[model samples]
Target: MNDNDKQQGPDNGGSNPWMKNLLIWVGIFLALAVFVTIFNGPAQPAATSTIAYSAFLDKVEAGNVRDVNVAGEVISGTLKDGSKFRTYAMVQDPELTPSLRKNGVVITAKPEDGPPIWQYLLMQSLPFLLMLGLAFFILRQMQKNSGSGAMGFGKSRAKMLTQREGKVTFDDVAGIDEAREELQEIVEFLKDPTKFARLGGKIPKGALLVGSPGTGKTLLARAIAGEAGVPFFTISGSDFVEMFVGVGASRVRDMFEQAKKSAPCIVFIDEIDAVGRHRGAGLGNGNDEREQTLNQLLVEMDGFEANEGIIIIAATNRPDVLDPALLRPGRFDRRVTVPLPDIEGRVKIIEVHMKKVPIAPDVDARTIARGTPGMSGADLANLVNEAALMAARLGKRLVAMAQFETAKDRVIMGTEWKSLVMTDDEKRMTAYHEAGHALVRIHEPASDPIHKATIIPRGGALGMVVSLPERDSYSYHRDKMYADLATVMGGRVAEQLIFGYDKVSSGASGDIKQATKLARAMVMQWGMSDKLGPLQYEEQQGETFLGYSQTQRHNMSNETALMIDSEIRALVDGGLARATEVLTKHIDQLHLIAGALLEYETLTGDEIKRLASGQDIGRIDSDMKGPSVPAGGTSIPKTRRPKGPFGSPAPQGA
Candidate 1:
């Protein structure tokens, strides 16, 4: 038989064979008992005779007799005291006749001769037969305990998948072009081992797939196995460990042996870091068990003999925490990183997942990909399924673009908080707060384009202004950084501009924290402050308990720390001043947008643009219906100082 038949045979060998044998043995034993009972009929008398004695007073009793025989129910016999006893016709009552009560009679007589030799032998061997049966039972139990029993604990837990079982090929995995290309070579090597060996080249000992969870590392490994048409042994690292001490090492050895036997095989270990954590890193009496397992794994990976035709592939998100020995050149050899997909990669992933789904013609995967920047392949798949489910819930025949959009919003934010209660004053404050962000983004030329603004509460946010880049960008410029900071501070600036020092809520806590971090990084880390002299004041110090220490702490004096703090504060103050000036100039337009927001509860970027430009509020244009803007129209400008910091240009728009 082929390898597939062999693997399947072993999987079913233990239980199926045992059951068949057990049933056959049980049938045999039952048949033997039945045959023995049928052949061995009721006991028969050798001679007919009768014996009699008084049950109460048996000093002497007499009856007729016949031939002397051991199997006879009644026989000629004499009492031990030399009294005579007839073996037959001793009873006159019908109930006491020999034919009526055959074995019920008790005679106080001894036979002239002892029982027959065969009967004596049968009686003597009873204890030996019982002893033999007991010994057989113990031997059977011992045999069961030796093999296919508790001793089978040393068996490997890896599941063997033959060529026909793992049907997933490289075609199924999408959006990981580079990873796929690298893995394709491994598959080629597995298929044609001699091609690489002829050139004195050694196949990589192992390849570790490093990525965040749900990035399809395991899937890629399976695809490689499918492409190579080899036996795939799939297991997790945790399967190697048990409560016992040596079990994990034994399991590792057994797994490697099995893989070696099944040559041209791929051993896929998911979450390898579970068994390969950094040695001697634990605090309380180092974990000897895990360390032992890791040592065994290292030996198995790179021992005296090279593992030809046997390839090991492991996946882990926490590759950084793995032991250094496992990652050395001769062991893991190669590490492939699978990061979150870019826009194009996300589009490919969406397309791969959407093939099974019935989607509307207008449902654009590219648009969905552009909206979801940091989503992984798994996330895109989930998004597609979620969109399909939303369509089904709405009783649509196919998933539409609107459903995908809603799913994107649900994934980014959360479900709509329709039941959340809010007073009119709170709603107005939220509208103004959101309007502040929108207006600031519109006026700041370097800021990303505003997509939409809403006073409707979602994901616990009372209101939000969504701004997105026209295209996906990898790098951020300094002007964009400054503009982002201005947008972050817009709400506070608007509150101060309109209410003139009225009560301000702590709703901007996250905004303040982010803006502060960015401003501090600009000064101390990025060296945006000219006074700092382009020095990196932030020291990373390699994953310390607390955050990185500032360079000024150890090297500089208290006066220097004071100077650094002052510089940082000055930088942030300048950004806040710019935000204030812009908000103050556009105060009228801000109020108008805020009023419109309070009435409509939501607004697109075009509506805000028209209101800011002092256009009459007549019919809503088609572009204003959504977030689209008029072609070639520039956004409103930020308030600029005329000559110096003292005098500035007044806001021109409504």
Candidate 2:
């Protein structure tokens, strides 16, 4: 630690964070108190000079009243001697007025006067004013949450970032070097436009970043603005569209006008597919809010001059769905594809993310990258974060290699279902099933190595066998596909040999589905089938709007479809037969592996190989002697069963 950090004490020099918030709340409370005190004023004393009814009548007859004012049942007046008094009189006193006039006292009769003008106005208008204020507050809250209100429908909701707002330069981004290089030209042009102008070159109007989700498209756009030290205006495609037709167009104009004002600036539109979809697609109703907005956007792009300093950058995962005009040369002139990071790219990404974490010395970023084959940039970031969180949860000071491994498994295979319960028979079956897969994968030279085997329930699996390649493979071969099929069928074959056909569980349903898909792909897509020849039988039509292929059709006849199905079935059956033969030859190893699984619950590849090798050494003596002669030599002798997962005696061959 540095000396300044070490010398720091509890009484720090910086301002307290709570001081500002506390002052704001205190001011609000004081204002509310003052408002309440002003509205509810102090109380007044009662008048003590009120005379009785008879006394009031007597005084009216005696000419003591100089002037009398009758307001409701009370009479208020000034006496002749300049003394003021008030008295109560009944409404039935008809002679009171006459008596006052006979005594020569001036009398007037009128209704009671109301309160002061200020108080009166306050009573009548306060409710309406409060209601209006509440309505305005509610409208503003709605605008904040929904991004638009009745009055603000045409206002641009673009988020403006000053030059200092986003400090993310090119150095902050990694894993997509090609995309960075493609954007470097724009950065240079933005920094010094005279160099490009001298060469008679015009900067591209817009650049569209296309990639899968979590591929760092938005981050790269921000980096471009950051490196150039220019203002960045960001908005989502959905921000332009509204329920009203013209509002979308108005918002587009406002956004462009803002971009123009902040010249030498960049505007980023995220998820542009929401507003830039293909026009007249069969999807929406006849109303064209999105189309009108897109039209306005096109006009604004075309209206800009060559030397105008504004540049637009848009991001979308589905570029195929955008309007054709948006992709034209004058609009989005450049297209940059940000694909998923490869092995080396992943290693770089991991290194960048690891800087934020207190990682252990043994945590090899390159090893972690190799373990994660198909992960994107965002996925790797989340994996690192998840590892840190796991380490923190365990009360560890540093994020270790084991934590990263656990995090990778959690991201790929899902959280372990530790609470799931299984019976002894089911657990035994799961053990044998997983062990079958391990044996086939270990023996097959073409298949990837088995990394892990576990009978623990996770996600939708009662048991799992994971195979990881030694290195990343970009292409697949027919031999590898066949080996994969055999590995998939191994579990079912083991169940059939051990517990008979009826006792086999339905846990292999996923395995069968995957095996069938591979088999069909071989026949229809890969054209690796001997009977089907080297012709494509199925065609995948491109999506009309914005989606995956709408449908796949078989161009061949129904008879040919039958043949394809037959070929798929033949491939599966052949895989099953091959798996049975391998399992039978290493039947002792399979039994030994299953027993190990029931004891350990999970096994690494190295542990499985060690156990299998030890069992092979013991079986060499038995293999030298010819087996007891059988008619077909297909059946094998069964060994004594060990204790099952739930401590029950299992069947002999189980």
Candidate 3:
């Protein structure tokens, strides 16, 4: 602590804060006493009425007057029936006293022609005093919030995090373990810089966390704050910018000044790409306002005037567009990649979220995690919350496996639309279409296991067939890509075979679009085309950030472009031919699965397998079998209608 700080103590504005408060209250009490004394007078009578001067004289002559209090020329009085009245006499009433005396009415006169000298002085000075008090209060506020007052746009808006509610530690965070590990050293450096300084290893000036949105970058930063036990200042890069020029740069300077004051602290700037994008990327000069802000940030991070104890931690999903100067060795010496959680990380995340909710015994973290590939920590948290809401909606005390399934389905397949009515023929066609996808996926060795297939409308699709990976696949092989292409084309191929090409509906538009894109990626980018010779013939169609896209160089001629187009077409057609062959061979099994879907409207992978092998899956014909329930069970299909007055489920099969 500095000598000045130690000498001042915590008294702030005075030597003794309690004594200062006592004096303030004393002043307020004296002011209130004076104000009341100056304004105090006789209270107004109940229900006083204003009457004309002639009526007042008539009341007096009729002997209806009870009593009156007169102040100056204004008269207020009550009648014999206990009603009150008041009136102003513009001129002197010489006969009023005579009439009152004759009628035996009690009269009290109060001379209010002018106020006392002291009261008059107070009344006129009270307004000025109020204005002075307001001015004093404003002055006090200005002194405290000097740099952050109105017209102080240059002041930094960074908030100092308090360790109260919503505080997070390392134990609170799950997934992105790699990024968390990379940031732990930052916490160590903040807690005890001597641990590293002795070894000649000064901590990095800044660490940049690069990740996809919702991948827990901010959580990692919060964890550091919780562990470091030091001042933590958080601000967004967008907060530094303003409508006026030079404001963003000034804010950057003020923010660094704050961080330096609380040395050995952590400053987290979220979405730094907002102000640190590549200079001149936009339609402006190099010295634009945002560019100036970026320049200031760059200098403060690694300038001649050292920021010895301030460690900067910036998080952005768009690291590709950030200025290169911000990523130099003296600035962001470490780049931590917080990728989407893998299977194990996903299980940990699910378990972390599960702790916050009431989970039934039926809930399995591994099962949920295995089904959710590439979900970020935020996504898993949302999934758990949705499941809890679903359970609450059903009045269930705990979030069971059923709610989790519904939540996952809602996230993956989009929202279910049970009210979407389709004709029997349309339903049958959709069943056949999805059945083909399920059958193809099952037959392809390289394909992932089919999780579920339903002819029920969800999102924009009349039917959906979802496949879940056994484990998260890091990279796609040629065989897997081919299998994906065939699976995507299965619906279209099925429609063409059953409802001839001439009668095929445009329901396969999505499938066609997906297939075309995948095939193009494979041939043009993945080098899966023999003609393309295992080389990237086009831009990678990779992450586009900051509205920046690489200008397509004419690396290939028009002939090569045609070849690329042909290669993409060939790949797609090959997938279609493969699907056609597979469906042709399993036409009988295809018919069986389609019939099952027509009756049930949805089937899980296990159910499809059991039914395809000729097992009854809860069919109402006194034949079908389902493991979840018995035949004619309470479990109802999506498309079933009421057959009787009691709303019994339909027994008819399409």
Q: TM-score: which candidate is best?
A: 2
Candidate 1 achieves a global lDDT of 0.71
Sorted by lDDT, highest first, which candidate order results? 2, 3, 1
Candidate 1 per-residue C-alpha lDDT over 308-407 given as tens digits, one digit per residue, 9 for 90 to 100:
7888899998776788999999888889887767777888889999999998999888878877877888888889888999999999999999899888
Lowest summed lDDT window (length 10), candidate 2: 645-654
Q: For model 3, which pairs clash?
A: 49-85, 49-86, 616-624, 616-625, 617-625, 618-624, 618-625
Model 2: residue 526 alpha-carbon error in angstroms: 1.7
Q: lDDT values of the candidates?
A: 0.71, 0.79, 0.79
lDDT by residue (tens digit), candidate 2, 452-569: 7877665667678887777888888988988888999999899988999888877678788889988988888878889989877777675655456654646678889999999999
Model 2 RMSD to the real structure?
8.8
- What's each prediction's clash count? 5, 0, 7
On residues 1-654, what C-alpha lDDT tens digit does candidate 3 reach at each position?
A: 742343234336565756765776687678877777677744455587789988988888999989988897889878999998988899988888888988999989976446767778887797689668757756655645635644667889898775643668988888777778888888888777888888778778888999999999888888897887666789998998888899998998889888777676789999999999888776676778898899898877766222277888899998878878888898889999989999999998899888889999989999999899978899899999999999999999999999999999888777866555566677777878888888888889999998888876666676788888898888899999899888888887887888897967777777888889888888767788887888876673433544856635347789988988899899899989999999999887777788777766678888877766656554353344434333222222455632223221111111
Q: What is the C-alpha RMSD of each candidate to the true structure, in Å?
A: 11.1, 8.8, 7.5
TM-score (C-alpha, index-matched) for candidate 2:
0.80
